[model samples]
Target chain A: MSEAARKGMKPKKNRAGLWGIYLALALIYIWAFSGMNLPEIKPTAGQITKSIFNGMFHPDWDYVSDPGGEDLLHGLLDTLAIAALGTFISAVLCVPFAFWAAANMSKGKAASGTGKFVLSFIRTFPELVMAIMFIKAVGPGSFAGVLALGLHSIGMLGKLFSEEVENMDLGPTEALMATGANRFQILWFAVIPQVITGFLSYTLYRFEINVRSAAVLGVIGAGGIGTPLIFALTSRDWNRVGIILLGIIVMVTVIDLISGYLRRKIV
Target chain B: MMNQPIKTSIPKPPSKIKNYVTLLLVLFLLWGSSIQTDSSLAELVAGFPNMMDLLNQMVPPNWGYFDNITDAMLETIRMAVIGTTFGAILAIPIALFSASNLIQNIWVFYPIRFILNLIRTVPDLLLASIFVAIFGLGSLPGILALMVFSIGLIAKLTYESIEAIDPGPLEAMEAVGANKIQLIVFGVIPQVAAHFISYVLYTFEINVRAAAVLGLVGAGGIGLFYNKTLGFLEYDKTSSIIIYTLVAVLAIDYISTKLREKLL
Candidate 1:
């Protein structure tokens, strides 16, 4: 122990690095603020703000549902559906990628390293960007959103799944090997069984995140509640916008709660 | 060959009923989702040729168009830097208040935590869209949106970590008759400083990604170019923008990750 601490007093802290940190921080702040013009409050900002608050307090209850057609309820359901399918597709597809990326599953670091690189590369593309790309291919609809989410989620899921594989107990693999089990057999019986629960929990976690993404995909015409939300935004229909925002918040919160509970149960 | 009973009986495996039920539910949800989204194999097949056409056009990215987006790309980084700094600054009080172990008042922490959670539910881009409505089309809305996003993320993580900080030091400080501020400065800050800094850095990384896409709603960033290129069917330019974004994001991620490892 330091002499000060040994004497029941405070030890002197190293402060040399603190000044450097402060200087760098100051420089960064200066650089950040130098580029842009100050923000202008829109002329209608006050009126719009008042209206938005009023609309939020008195949401258009009529927009909650319409007779057998698109409404808030359907919008929320479509968002949930997109999240569910996307999570499922990614969960199933990430398995092979996970196996490829897991260090224990590969013969050499090079193999797993390449797999890791690919996953990271995929991760850089936001699902929104992917949705745009898919809309070009599949047309602007909820299906495009699904494809985007499904594709984008593989990056995160593959990384998480691979880590789970790497952490799997090796005893069973060795025991099965001693019994003359084939490679696939060893993996199927030993690795798969151990990691399935972890994988499921991660998938549910991703599902929760996907719900938020799916809600906004409609802004670009990729489909879901976002489509209606964007329309409400453009039309300056404060009540409609308020209700859609409310729907999104409620849906996201509910899904997060359920998924979090399930994850806790699994893990 | 005979199916013979083992001399030493092994216990049967755990019930698979839960697994079976989960699998069934997943399958049903997938079926419903596909129908609801109008996703069909036939449509995918039909679209394959179009995708191939897009790929053919995208291979030769317009490297020359990089000049146009350079300013916007830098603006994106600037937005992230400012937003994350502002967020880290604001998160301190919120995090301190929400950390029940520190504040020791249910009434104080509970409402703060609830509002924090509510803020976290809205996506960053959605927040940007709202800010755009209020501030008009500019980087200000984007910066404000990212700042708000970073607040939710950083404060939540910071408070959680704060609650887990070592209590012995605080107790010692209390025994020394230190007041609340003194106790916090002498005890709490030292313990959580590294963690708080690391969380802020992590938020910066996420904000960079979010900021890049904020331009979609006229919030200002590289996302504005994404809309422009796509709207004009300039596939080549779109590819270049994507490439630039990827390189910038990856570079930042590498440096920030290294810094986090050192800090923590």
Candidate 2:
């Protein structure tokens, strides 16, 4: 049965068709450019270079230690607090939802499949889009930022949790069930041990991502450092901008170092 | 020979009251967070209609505005392509250094991992903003930001995959008197190259989306246009930009996913 079908199967003659599309697109581009009489880009590289040095390199030392410094510090604190709270909430909520969504933990396919579809939809939209929507409803603040971060984290954590569940060893679970343990007892004794380290690693990793996301949620008026950052940059306050950048770099580097250390110890 | 069962001590189970107390504590925390955040269920319900109203405003999107955004849209894709390529090239050495199996010294791997972690900690928007502050607002800063962002992403994934690879080929290379560089070239790179490209393309897809939004921070690309249009409350133009972005992202994601499936 297999040999007959294998002989009958002919590779589709679609290779030329693919190249035909590419050629067509190239021609269209050329034609469009000629018709439009596209203007040549003559950007002044020297001007850009001068501006970079003036605005970026010659950072305002006075601003770094003055009112700009105070504003930047407050922004930094706000960003960190929101990120921390969001990560904590998401980790707590996502653990139980992940268990229900994971194939190995749920009793049947229906429950797991439904849980997964909901999470998938949540993941399809970016955090910015969610923040925009929440800001419209809740008004711009750290609360909206937290909600956006938490929802997005749920999707990420759920997927990671399912993977951890899928790759777990089944031997201990069978042994625990053989001892006449209830569902909860079996899960606690068998499943949690294998997945605890993985769960911790995933949470730490998400925390790193959350810190980054929270820093920018302010662009949409969801609150945090982004508001002040946008203000300083647009105002051409190079000194304040430099201070903000410095603060962000320091904070992110520290979070990275601590999370990295913890992850290594756990794993 | 004496055969005796090996026995391990098992602790007593926690009482039911303990479980209930833990549950109560969790509930308390949830309530506390909700109160602090002022997330009332009543507010959410009341706000549902506003969401519907916003959606209503966005519907029947102005298709004509698509033409206006075409150039910015193409630039965004171009930025992503260049950025992803640059990042992937840099990721190779960083990933090699970070892989536990490849780097025998704990010191080297730990430090390399620390750098990767730090790079990954900053969101694409924040990175773009910082770069813009340094480089001045333009496509160059956008590209640089995306390049750094993609490097962090690809290095993390590639190194994790590398650590999980079969060590047999590496052992054989070492047995053949290969130096460290030669051993990696012969033993490690080939096995992980396809997966590496898969990660690169996946990161490229993300970079495309991220680049589209970088303009919001004045870094460069289509996002600047987004900010401009949305600033004036030009919902029609905003809708057009969003539609174009969604279509481009979906198309790239489809192709990338297919390629990744084939490579892996």
Candidate 3:
């Protein structure tokens, strides 16, 4: 039976198709490998690597607090604040976009399709780039980080919100319509009630992500732990870098756990 | 959507207190955050013209700048390809170990899963910056960072898929006195290979985007051009770099997404 199946015309064609894919993959890999220009080895590479590892093991605990507001604690606070405001801004801005992108809400596929396209276009721009743009506007600070994250979160949040809208129980909308409720009434009483929880849950999820992004926004002088982090790295302050990384890890982990629990309760 | 009992003369509405409290709390939180972050609407309004001026200068992207960036962009894609390849290779054993269904040992999977979660917590850019700090900058650091990120992402997705694979073939193989390695080869690999490939492609899509920005921390890519242009006040060139990155990211995303769709 195996020999007959293996020798079948369909099997033969399948094998040929698989080989073609393999051949193409091999060529692509070769091209990629050829383009690689590995950097020359720095003489101190091993020593630096060992020092970084050692720093991680013995992180400077003193950096955890300071009278000055520029310590790790304050940087984390600024990061959280930026993330919170950013999430709030996106949560508000995305509501209309969500309705626009929802296929069921729009009369025609073209309308919804364009909205989807616009959201994806927005999503393609990384938040870091947006931060730079905003820095040009606000002259660099936590404000720029907030604006950037707020703007960038819309892409993801809008898409998620639109899906929530599309997947909602239409029975409620239909029933509301039968009751002669206007669009606003239907939206407020029927659509809003169903989607509000999903929207809040998604915003929380985005907040967790924004925190991570915000942690690095400071690298560009947009203001966060990242600013100090870059400063430490440049000055070869490995222990400071260690503390910041640890703080980020802890903060992100805590945010994820809290948001996950809340989302579970919400959904 | 509202339903009422026909037998009841009148039904009292549920309390709106929770709704009011939640709204109030949200408003208070927003207020506090805005203050903490020094985010003022007035400042944003005042700065709007500056933003417009910057945007005005960015018009007419320097078409000539594309030639300079072509190599850097190609290098970014190469880094992503090699990184994802390495990650996928390394992820196989990690994914296999972490999949509780396959390993069947708390001691084996839990610590690995914990490490996986910790790795996932760090953003790719942060990883790149950290590597750059240690290695003192280069494309190698970017590649290493991407490899670490892909390991986290690919392993998590692969193990999840592995756990969800059809158990029938696994049980049959076991029933036939197949050893662990034989059971995996005859049963597990066949079912998971497609999903694993799909996940790897998905990771590649993300890696391209991350790799493009790695140079921000001096790890490598077209991102360094961003610094150069902005530092030089070459707004037109900066815009071109952004456009280049956008096109590259979109193209890779499109290809990998299509491939993943076909695979899965």
**What's the number of clashes in each of the models?**
0, 0, 0
Q: Could you give the fnat of all candidates in order?
A: 0.67, 0.18, 0.68
- Residues A57-97 of candidate 3: C-alpha lDDT, one tens digit per residue: 88989999999767999999999999999998999999889
Writing each residue's lDDT as its tens digit, candidate 3 over B51-164 gives 999999999999998999999999889999999999989999999999999999999999999999999998888888878876777898999999999999999999999999
In the range A145-240, model 2's lDDT, one tens digit per residue, is: 887888879888888888799889999989988888998998888998899899989988988878778889987788777887777766867556
Model 1 Cα lDDT, one tens digit per residue, B1-264: 999877787778999998899779878888999999999879988998988898788889999999999999999999999999899999999999999898888999999999999999998888888878777899998989998999999999999999999999999889889999998788989899999999998999999999989999899989999999989999999999999999999999999999999997
Best-matching candidate per DockQ: 1
lDDT of 1: 0.90
Better of 2 and 3 by DockQ: 3
Give the CA lDDT, 0 to 100, for residue A111 in model 2.
Answer: 88
TM-score of 3: 0.95
How much does candidate 2 score in TM-score? 0.69
Off by over 4 Å in 1: A1-19, B1-14
Expressed as tens digits, the lDDT of each residue in A96-187 for candidate 1 is 89989999998799999999999998899877888988888989999999999999999999999999999999999999999999988998
> CAPRI band of model 2?
incorrect
